[model samples]
Target: MESMTETEQRATRDQRARFEALARVVTEPLHRYLLRRAEPDQVDDVLSETLLVLWRRIEDVPGLEASGYVSGPAPDPDAVLPWCYGVARGCLANARRADRRRRSLLERLTWTVAGAARETGDADHTALHAALAQLRALDREVVLLWAYEELTPSRIAEVTGLSANAVSIRLHRAKKKLAAQLERKTGPHPGHETDEGQGTATGNGNGRSSR
Candidate 1:
């Protein structure tokens, strides 16, 4: 291989530094978001895709000052995290769809789970899943973003391309629907308690959380 010129070496170093800084800030938060939405085994793969997108689109990531300070009206974490989450959401969905296909193929091959135990061990999670399944896709997304991801409505607006008011409204309605579904399933006090309207998520149009 040819040796790198000094200029090339400097560029490489700068790129590495920027990537390291971005990863240091985003990796943990992105991983947490994926963990909330993705299957346990899928988290790593989804997170890798999210980070890859971040690196490839580094220039677009806001708040990276040339002086090594992530200074601006929007900090690196605030600007990058939600966008990373949007990317991670797509990664997770792709992973889940692939998993479903694989499972379908395995089922067709008559594979038995004689020793494999289902991971739906928690009753609360089971109810929650059932309730979430009942929601419209958009409503479900709003709910997951709000309750599970714990994103503010404005932040979710950034991720989902909805206005802040739209996000808040969707979140408010989604929570009520989810809570009602859980109550129906678990018969009152379903224990899938959600904190709706708990944030600055005020809007006229109702929305739900993300997942």
Candidate 2:
């Protein structure tokens, strides 16, 4: 094998450094993103796949250019996170498709929110999961990206490939629908009591936990 020239060697080092920095900034949020969307068993594999794509496409990440060469400052999260989320979403979809191809229909049907909820035996969690399941797939995704990921409508648009206006509309409608569903399921005061006797589920009126 031929040895790399000095310039090529330097470029390779810079790329590694850049990727390390990017990974540091993105790995935690990306893990949370996957955990919310993927099966527990699949989250690690999907997160690895997502990070592999980020490594290969570091040049495409926004704010990376500003990080400079060789162990520079980390890229701004705001500038790159939406794009990173988009990458994870695609990777997750790919993993899901692959899993569907490998598993029998019976096996796939066993993987469900209701089944998981029953195992947890948490009434609030069960109600939340049931309510979320009622949403159209895309709308549920929008709400998760908003509430779980704490992304704005514009950022969700970047992640979901929808226009900002479309994301906003979906989020608004979905939140209302979720609120109504939770109220029906858990009563008008659809929340748990805190030590102070305050309702913890008064979560932005979106049927999500305020935490």
Candidate 3:
């Protein structure tokens, strides 16, 4: 292998540092987000897919300051984390689609095998799932991103390709709609009321927003 000059070595070190910083910031939260939405067994696989994309596009990971603080005027997390969520969103979607295809193939090949894979039921869980299913895709995403993932509307805007104001409005409306549906189905659980007028920013542990 060719020896790296001093400058080349420094540049390589900086790149690795930036990638590690992003991984440190995103790994746990990203995995949790995937876990909340994905089938339990596929969460790790989907998380691996998300991280693989991150590794492949390390140079393109945004918000890394040259000094490695990964911060700017607004905050490094705001810039970078949303972008990471966007990547994860796509990876999760692809994984789910592939899973469906695989299940379909299995069922076609052997009904007994496929029947054994059926998911177990819970009434509360089923009600929530049904309510969520009733929502339009965008509305469902806004609700899940806010309530389940604890993402702020601005961050969700980055992931869903909506304006911040749009995300806020959609999230607000979706919450009301979901609340109503759930109430009608199974009555309110404790603490079921939506927290209205919450600010658009609820900073995650790292103060990152979704992109």
Candidate 4:
């Protein structure tokens, strides 16, 4: 195993410093990415744009990216992230725009397929909706992107500002959490098939909080 060279070490430190600038000084509540999306479909769009912004402006950094020359207008100081939450926010806004052009009601990201064993009753759906509301924004985004939008990890990488590896890890964690949450609420999930929209999420017909 070779150790990092001097230049590489410095580069690593510099990268960390720059990331910190975006996360700490630039954006507030950096973790609060997905909740900002009003609708589930909005999450996919936002994640896509956010990743694009990160890749494009990464060399310059967001606010500091333009600090060297003041000739052009900057994206604004407040809009930064570990990579610039601006990317995330921008993605969200773009997703919102795209969603407007099409149906706004479909859960683009967090889709649920109802199992035959589980009745198509509104009660099952109602409980599922309530449980979904309880998830953190990050978890929700992961669930939607993987379960609903059906985007691949590389594609998800474009939205989340994370490498595909990171996206996979996050998604796995999100699923585990979601399953546990569902189990706790409904005893266990009933099986279901969700193709397109309007399917049932199965559970033991257990009650859930109306959060």
- The lDDT leader among the candidates is 2
Which portions of model 2 miss their true places by more than 4 Å? 1-4, 66-71, 104-211
For residues 68-136, write the lDDT of model 3, one tens digit per residue. 434423226677888899999999899877655444432321232222212212212455567668999
Per-residue alpha-carbon lDDT of candidate 1 for residues 106-198, written as tens digits (9 for 90 to 100): 232112222111222222255556766888888778766665456888989988999999988887776666556655554433333344645
Q: Report the lDDT of model 3 for residue 111.
A: 31
Comparing 3 with 4 on TM-score, the higher-scoring candidate is 3
Give per-residue CA lDDT, model 2, range 100-206, as digits (tens): 53332212212321222222222225565687799999998997776556688999999999999999998778766766675566443323334244444553778
Output the better candidate (3/4) by lDDT.
Answer: 3
lDDT score at residue 115, model 4, on the 0-100 scale: 27
Pick out the ten consecutive residues of candidate 3 with the lowest summed lDDT.
Answer: 115-124
On residues 7-40, what C-alpha lDDT tens digit does candidate 4 reach at each position?
6786666555554444444344533467554455
Candidates ranked, most accurate by TM-score first: 2, 3, 1, 4
Q: Relative to the unseen true structure, what is the C-alpha lDDT of residue 147 in candidate 4, on a scale of 0 to 100?
A: 55
Cα distance off (Å), candidate 3, residue 74: 13
Residue pairs in clash, model 2: none
Runs of candidate 1 with Cα error greater than 4 angstroms are: 1-4, 66-75, 111-211
